[model samples]
Target: MPNSTKRGRRILAAGARTIGRGIVRTVTRSDAGAHWARVGGDWYETLGELKGAAMKLGQLASQYHDVLPPELSKQLARLQADAAPLPWERIREVLDGQWSAHQWQLIAEIEHAPLASASIGQVHVATLRDGRKVAVKVRYPGVAAAMDADINNLGRMLRMAGILPFDGDSLKAVLEEVRERMAEEMDYQREREHL
Candidate 1:
């Protein structure tokens, strides 16, 4: 089989596993059995694997302990600290595209390894031409392209799981809010200006 075909099959299988885990989680209430713990573990693993808007949504949802069951909130909160970091090659691609040779010349040193990583981007420790240490956040390439599809898929999953309101208006508003915040976060120039 072609490499692309194998990659596609792998992606699909991973997605199916996540969706199955989600279903199990949503159906298993804390009072039902100790199986909820397994559900939580599955959820954590799935969200860690899917480190984009899906993970972001999980982190956001975890904040609403008052609205969600304490057990569920605890499970989702795990996503906040746990996410798969982008590969070094992917991180390098973003840095290379953003900084030209002239710009890179100004940097005294840049750590190849990430200092911190989140859903939208990762931060690296860098010493500038001025010898001031700073943290540089590099947005993952293709995150913008994948953002919409990921959000929509997550929304559908949440709605189906009865975590999000089924009402169209409320769901629309929630999704819009997520999109706006994600867009702002991706805007490095805007973030720099704010900083």
Candidate 2:
């Protein structure tokens, strides 16, 4: 289990490195690297695969694109929520865990593909048996653990590279706040109720 976890981290780090390089390349040449990080033929799919703090950072960057360089802004603005969906089998498993089999059947048509994907969850368009159109948001399993590990790894790397502006304690506090917000975002029920 420990070995598998380490392997997963290494894979994720490699992906992040690829994304960082792609960002640099895109900045250097506007059109050359437009499709630098694509998944399922969509740029947003690549962002979804990152699935943690990295995704959040990308979303934030996109939101503030007006303040960014044109090249960077363009690339970040393409960070939509349409991600490669999980398999129907996996979706069924999650549904089974969240609702009874009969309740699951009441969903007339849950899109096999996700309509939108973010850091913690993906959204699907569905129609209920009662003929109501609803958006179903499902949280990804183990996202919190993955996100925490990745953030910690990034902070350590940045500090070691002398790139961080603040001291370790201050940085930790900031990370704690970020983690709390991410935790809130992960709660689908809470979000639904708020909406």
Candidate 3:
């Protein structure tokens, strides 16, 4: 995960380029397809690397092809729920922190590779010393801080760029919902209960 400042710049820079391109495209009356594709690529690269609220928003937005440009939606769809998994070293750090020494010792074997990867966490299959297999979901490091910065920055960036279709009230409502969902997703206990 990037430090907050670097992440902020990455997202803001993408939004700035998108705004600049939109302006030029509007004035030139050029084909929108390729222009939109480049815009989508910028967003995809930025959000995929960040892997937080904005990326989640992009993934959901990808489904609404009628509302979003097809090219943009296409790129967003690439940031699927099963995003690129983090390496074992990163996952091990979380496990080391969360599990007691006794709990850690119970694992006879654990796969470094994840069965699934999401914005918040990933599931790895582990075998207990007693020979029972279980799936463990480990939260990514720095996700809470990343989500916090992302939520704070994304709306302002979009509004400043004049990119969102909604007005202030509507945008506020949308952002509130994003916040709520982010909260829900981050709560591991709640997720387990719901499941």
Q: What C-alpha lDDT do the candidate models reach, one value each?
A: 0.69, 0.59, 0.82
Best by TM-score: 3
Residue 176, candidate 1: alpha-carbon lDDT:
81
lDDT of 2 by residue, 1-195 (tens): 123266256545545654665566568764433433331123234445655664564455455445444444455555554344566677667777878878888888888777876666677899999999898887765666676765666456435532235578976776676678887887777877898
Give one digit per residue, the lDDT tens place, for model 3 in 57-166: 77766776777778887877888853877899999988898899999889999999899998767899999999999999887787878886887688888788765567
What is the full ranking by lDDT, best candidate first?
A: 3, 1, 2
Candidates 2 and 3, the one with greater lDDT: 3
Q: TM-score of the candidate numbered 2? A: 0.63
Q: What would the TM-scores of all predictions be?
A: 0.77, 0.63, 0.92
The candidates, ranked best first by TM-score, are: 3, 1, 2
Worst 10 residues of 2 by lDDT: 35-44
Question: For residues 1-195, what per-residue lDDT tens digits would candidate 1 score against the true structure?
Answer: 113333234334444554576567568633523444454555666655656565676788778778765666788788888666787788878778878999888899888788898877888899998989999888766667666776776666566556543477787788888888888888889889997
Q: Which sections of candidate 2 miss by over 4 Å?
A: 1-8, 11-48, 58-84, 162-170
Best by the lDDT measure: 3
lDDT of 2: 0.59
- Which pairs clash in model 2? none
Quote the lDDT for 111 in model 3. 94
